[model samples]
Target: MSSPPNMSTTTTLQASPTGIRMITPKSTEEDTRLNQVIAQVVSFIQTNLCEVDKLTLNTGLDIEDSPRLIRVLDAYGVRYFYHGSILVIMGACPLNSVINTLVLNILDQRSTILPHELCPYFSSYRAGILCSGTIKGKGVRPQLRIKIPDDSITFHHPGKHTIYDTIMIEVAFSESRGDLHREMLQYFEHYRPAQLAILVKIEEDLSSRTPRTDPGFRDRAAQLLLRFGNDLGKEIHATYLENSAHDTSVRPEPFTDDEILEQIQVEDWIGTIAADVEVWDLMHSEPRLRGSRTRLFPTPDRNSVPYIYAGDMIPLALHDSFPNLNVSQRLAIDTDLLCMRMAALIPRFACWRAINFFSPEDEDEDMDYNADDDEGEE
Candidate 1:
């Protein structure tokens, strides 16, 4: 009863699934245009660029010369590419302002780029912790040159663990971590060292925010510290420390080592990890009545607080070095939370405040807080 299909219906029938969608071939004209663009970009990079060992701006290019380069790339709508150690230009993407700024800085002979803008893929550094022995082993050369594939600088180390140690340092700078698991596996399988100590460093860009006064930034940084170190494993050991230097621009106070202990200890370890905590703005220049209780000095049976000191008030009780009470009776505060508080205050106070506890301890004490330095006899 069905009539034969009309000629128009036959022409409208759907093609095979593969042919109907997803694999449509490019037109001959479109293919030709793309090939031409690729050829032009390759030629431009070859003729106009110089190959360098690293991504730094010491590439002999200057401010006057950068605009011309930008124009050349703009003509082809070029963005960026990574080849060897240098970031190369290939094509343009509208969302590449960060890369564009880096290129401008490189041309202008600037010393550094914004840390957030840096792409780990372009640099040879991979992301992870790296450790090397401090002492040299027997029969191994007492000194040897250490070279990193990603870095041009040649470091002189006391031991010959450069191959293994260098890998650790290289991976530390990397932001892309998809390939890290494979690289880590390779390292463990090859060297088979008895123990590996992972060094984790949390660096905050203090020029941007006030983590001390603002709770949001402080809380976020604290969270990152936990994610970076705490979530890594159970075998990890953590410590908190602070290094302060005077910013004559804001505070006239000179840097002083006010504590017997080098590293600043966290106030309450359990409380810091479990609940939200805020540090007193001890260093904030804006005058305000000191708080009732500080991390270093807790109120004892609700005692009356002393009047604010006239000069730069170094609240001795706030520093972890002076713990008047037993820690077991007090709450536990995470090291990361302490670090976050310290980092946030640096920018707000315009001081050279560094939260450093990751480095190895020196055997000899260079300076003592209580002892006065001895001047040479006249």
Candidate 2:
């Protein structure tokens, strides 16, 4: 290949896949004009490029006057198309090192599209799919975990009781489509280990008078509790058990058995159990539930153990089974009990898996953030 006259730029160039050929003009007069024109073209390309693309190209272009260079390229009649920093130059290239450098420099800029930058876009679609099984439209819900503060109780006797408390809840969903489990893992991978506690509610007989108040009630309740615990552990994994050895605060050692029985108010116990069951019901419901829809389990201000009839056998079974267990054991039991309850009332509920997201620190942070926002506006 002969060098273009007075340009000192020469080489053979392959046609693009689309067969667009670049023609290099060789006259001395034309060379001088082309150099001036090339400058203008380069200037235009730089100016019109997206901010992200421009930052990428600028690093290598190293030209103090990029706008001028682009204008020179424009004057020479080189057409360029931009696809996110990828510059497809049309027209003529003499195939010299200078031209090659320019092409390669533009290609190098393509590397700036990082994986994390693309995640949000990908998750938007994935979130839609994951939430499709939900009752709410395609919106993602926020997931939350709450930890109750630890407080000491005073006794007229000589002993002090140390208490540790925590709770987990899934308050929101991530905005994405596809498999929620995978997306959740990826989205939360950057944070410390956390568990999600979902509350599911089901209608149960709570009337104060009934027939099966003795061994039958306890037996059935224990079985129902065992069922929920087993299924939840199997479906969501045993690692999420609130009272697992790994979860120090939920362990039974923090307080003596007598203190545990005394400090764990009946209302607190029922409220926590009810919350878990409500979430289970939502997840296990037929036709599936939406993120926007919620089932509330209101705890009575005054606590009283309801009398058990044959109609109330199932709920009573759950209550008796749950109250006697420690936090971890209770979580395990609730998982199974809820699953069994769903099986009988709504057969379709058997197919879904429970995802846990229980964390107390996260809840506190959210509260603090909201408080700060309120204070700021004042």
Candidate 3:
């Protein structure tokens, strides 16, 4: 959570009416304390400080910010960003599919160059890529309006350190997705060379376990069971639907075109469904460009890619955009291998704990936490 010069730290603050947004600490100790108090109030509204339901600063509802904990700088209308989050859930155990796990290894290899070797399309320009890099620009206030893009590429000036953004990718959750295209406008407003932006939409899955507001309920139930037997506990559990929780796979939401996004000139827009990757040209043009997506995500059955793809031949290849020198060929990203590795942590979800035989679902809806991390845009 990078912040301005005066602030010490920042965290998400979520409220019912206001929604969620990151807020930075006030400079003075007293001012900071005031922020904490406000966060506590919002926390109380959201969780009532229940011992069992308390959210750890570390892993609570992702992209969360308690309304009580913000500096309310009227000067800066309203804008915030997220650095990290809990998990967006892939299969039965949401814990298995984390944002960082999906991209870190691939990101490590591509971070230094334009992600996916698109630099060659730029002719003589030297460009670089960053995962979740913060884009700083002035907004309505004194502090900088930081826009953290999921994945972004920047072009460097000839023999200079300063770089300007060219393309950006964003993984947007439905809750805050309304701001999607508007953010692209903000990026263009700040970065003069910004050309393209990709948007990825992923929805959230609900957990089934019910958290108790009363800390002493368990102990009280134990005493009651000693006298009245386990029937009471079983009855209460069944009443709350605690005994029935199933794992039904949920798919990511499809991207809906907005007036703003449509007007921005999508020379092309590609949306991957299931395992099939397809690209579409929203802009009607002469010659009619079509892309072969079969080549993007080769095979789910076979783990290996047979041949190296030439930069020019690949579908969705950036036009006029130079392919990175490193991606001349040898551009095989083992999607299957990465996926299996990403789900490697599934067993630990409840591999088996005391009374864990039927762990049923993951965390309940009331205690939902999610983050779909993607290096160069989700």
Q: What would the TM-scores of all predictions be?
A: 0.18, 0.14, 0.33
Model 1: CA > 4 A from native: 1-183, 190-338, 345-378
lDDT by residue (215-267, candidate 1, tens digit) is: 44334333323333222211222221111122212311222333212222222
lDDT of 2 by residue, 246-341 (tens): 322232222223433332222211212122121111122222222222322233212221111111111222333333222221111223332333
The C-alpha RMSD in Å for every predicted model, in order, reads 29.0, 31.4, 17.7
Ranked by lDDT from best down, the candidates are: 3, 2, 1
Global CA lDDT of candidate 2, please?
Answer: 0.25
lDDT of 3 by residue, 136-211 (tens): 5542111123434544544443334445555444433322333444455454455444554433333323222222
Ranking by TM-score: 3, 1, 2
| Candidate number of the best TM-score | 3
Q: In candidate 3, which residue ranges exceed 4 Å CA deviation?
A: 1-37, 40-146, 153-158, 173-198, 204-334, 341-378
Measured with C-alpha atoms, the lDDT of residue 89 in candidate 3 is 15
Q: Would you list the C-alpha lDDT of every candidate in the order shown?
A: 0.25, 0.25, 0.33
Best by lDDT: 3
